[model samples]
Target: MTHVQDGGPAYWRVAIVEDHRLQRLRTEELVGRQPGLRVVRSCETLDELMAWMAGGSPQSLPHVVVLDLVVDRGRDADPAVVERLVRSGMRVLVLSAMASVPLVRAMIRAGVTGFVGKRDTEEDIVAALWAVLRRRQWITPELASVMAGDAQRPRLSDQEERALVLYASGLTLDAVAVALGVKRDTVKKYLERVKTKYADVGRPVRTKIDLNREAIRDGLMTASTVENDRR
Candidate 1:
């Protein structure tokens, strides 16, 4: 409960939001034992954490949340939930047993600062947590490889990727706009920006068909998605 007015807290506050009870306690214990970390909140679900976050005092919230994507009986936590927490001003460090590349990618899009596989050693987890607290991008080697796999592809913001995937998947501009809940012009801008990024990477997508092909190559969509469109 020590809060400095000018400088940050003396120690980092850590919250554990893991559905698995044993894992939750273990993580809580580990973080608590750390020299400069405190286990502020340990809960089974993000909803519980959000409920506790109701006080309107920033001090009530932890500095970083160690979250597991899977909850309840094998249910997956939506990336939107992660995004919400991140937007609330807490850094997120995913600590999940499910090392899914797509899930990691989605969480990254949702603004996760780092990730540590459940199978990773305690040292790795501690290191990842500290890195996140320092605003560093910490990712396991395996997860890093997954992200680096497409390093040659030009990066796009979340909006641009959504626009590319949906528009390239055969949706008209109007439909994409409706789906994204943006104006048609906004959607056009997103797609145009996506095209510019691709072009800057030397893989210009001049047409919608070219976009579809690029999307396929980026694994945003499958070839069958565009292939079936022709028929």
Candidate 2:
């Protein structure tokens, strides 16, 4: 990862994916004006972005991708596509109008490095990109507040927390069980207990994505945590 402290590159390469023509142009212009940022490509769809990556040299890949969660005329960007980008080593900084906790949590679990609300100013968006390039997680204050206000949040046991983090970081249950030196069913029970706790508090965790969000809100997940898991 590049860092400002280490005298990083002269300019960070950027890719943008926004379906709206005017919005795409505006974002491209805004990013171009930044002192240490450059737009390498501005695409209208995830497919176009993927094709660009496949056709370009490794060195031509953008340092960060500024993505719109909803693209293609109100359709959601496929999580699988986002996951592919992240697994390929491109950090994603989401720029979206949706600031709800569930959606933000879903993106994070999909490996997004940062998120900036569309209502935010250009400066805020630029800052988010920088944060992602530096291998940090960033979120709008409003979104942070919403996550913090989980009134029905449940406290987790140590084992349950471990299970949540491993599974939420994109690990399979069997892999998580191996990592914890426990049986697969034991790992499942741990996660089930976690879900039950949330349900008891009136916060339902019906899916792995929901569990990921809860883990994040409870501080069990972070950029460093995920990086450590990768290592």
Candidate 3:
């Protein structure tokens, strides 16, 4: 277990968090090939990773966690654990094929530093990580296309997005405030803005579920057109 002291030659301690076994292995292979990265863990879920962390396991709990959005059996990552990782000084890079525009917006609001699609080639994934390690935000071109799909897409503001994901993912406003590093009143204000935005569309956005369904139906994300972005 190599402890990467803060001032090294940009080498990274990385963990791959994907539910699929094959995908996890592939990610590990790609990370292994990259010059400055060490693949310390290849975990199948947040639970396993957390358990390893609890055991004081030194080979994992890396500086960078490459995450997949969907968990097995449709389980999602725990918002609390996500916050713990970020607060405990881990950088999270979402490496998912299931990223909708709303999801991407949500993650950004949650303070994720990087978002890369699983459809990307190994080289692209590596480059994305490099960008994040250098303290730059990186979103895969596919996700960029999702943003471009709706010229009038009234997506959530960063604050609103965080609030919405937390709300949609079953967190109370207070919990959202804690997770987002914001205040409860701030969460309320964002919710108010959310209501206003949806009201403009002749419907109200009362829950995260509503926003996600609408975002998909409106082609804001469903028509992501990843090929267009890569080309």
Candidate 4:
């Protein structure tokens, strides 16, 4: 773990994956100007970034990955790629135009540490990177309300709520089961019930990511809580 002392620089290696040439260059420039931050790699696609990572030494891996959710003429961002990046021990910050609740929830569940809208100011981008680097979660205030749609929030049974909190906290099925003092299969059953309950209220939780969003909305978990669980 590296730390800054005596007001000195704290270097953070960052990578960018954006398809648009102009946007990529602009983002690179913006990131370069930030204190204590460096743009280690800027590529047009996640594949290109992954290929570069494969050829480089582990020490060269970026501490943070700034990715676009939808890249023109390239593979769009997917949860699998986010999961892959998280599994590789890199903090991910999604900078995307798509700020829909579903998309934001999906990325969060996939383990991104922060999200910033494409329309956000350059300062917002820098702040997001700083938050993720500190193991915190950053979502703009507007998106935060979208994630917490209280008026349409669904109700959950005690068991279902417990299951959601445990699962969304990054616990495996077996581990959730152990915590709930139930069998692994029972944990799955509880999760299924929870899913149906959400769908009943017109809030579809079709995947693990959706369930994770619901957990956050239900006050069962926070983004920082999920990040901590992942760590």
Indicate which candidate wins on TM-score.
Answer: 2
Regions of candidate 3 where Cα sits further than 4 Å from its true position: 1-10, 57-60, 99-101, 154-231
68-171, model 3: which lDDT tens digit per residue? 87786646666447767777767888898854556555457557778888888877888888777765678776676766565455555555655664565556
Error of model 1, residue 10, in angstroms: 1.5
lDDT for residue 124 in candidate 1, whole number 0-100: 96
Each model's TM-score?
0.67, 0.67, 0.62, 0.67
lDDT of 1 by residue, 1-231 (tens): 444422557888888989888998899888887776888889888878878888647876799999998776655767778777776677999998755667766676566768889999999999999888877778787766666567568777656877787788788999888766689999999988989989888998889999988887877666665555455
- Candidate 4 global TM-score: 0.67
Off by over 4 Å in 4: 1-10, 154-231
Query: What does candidate 4 score in Cα RMSD to the true structure?
Result: 8.7
Pairs in steric clash, model 2: none
Off by over 4 Å in 1: 1-7, 72-74, 148-231
RMSD of 2: 8.3
- Residue pairs with colliding backbones in model 4 are none
Q: Is candidate 1 or candidate 3 better by lDDT?
A: 1
Worst 10 residues of 4 by lDDT: 1-10
Cα error, residue 65 of model 1, in Å, equals 0.5
In candidate 3, position 198 carries an lDDT of 68
Error of 1 at 71 (Å): 2.1
Write down the lDDT that model 2 would get.
Answer: 0.78
Q: lDDT winner between 3 and 4, please give it.
A: 4
For model 3, state the Cα shift of residue 9 in Å: 6.2
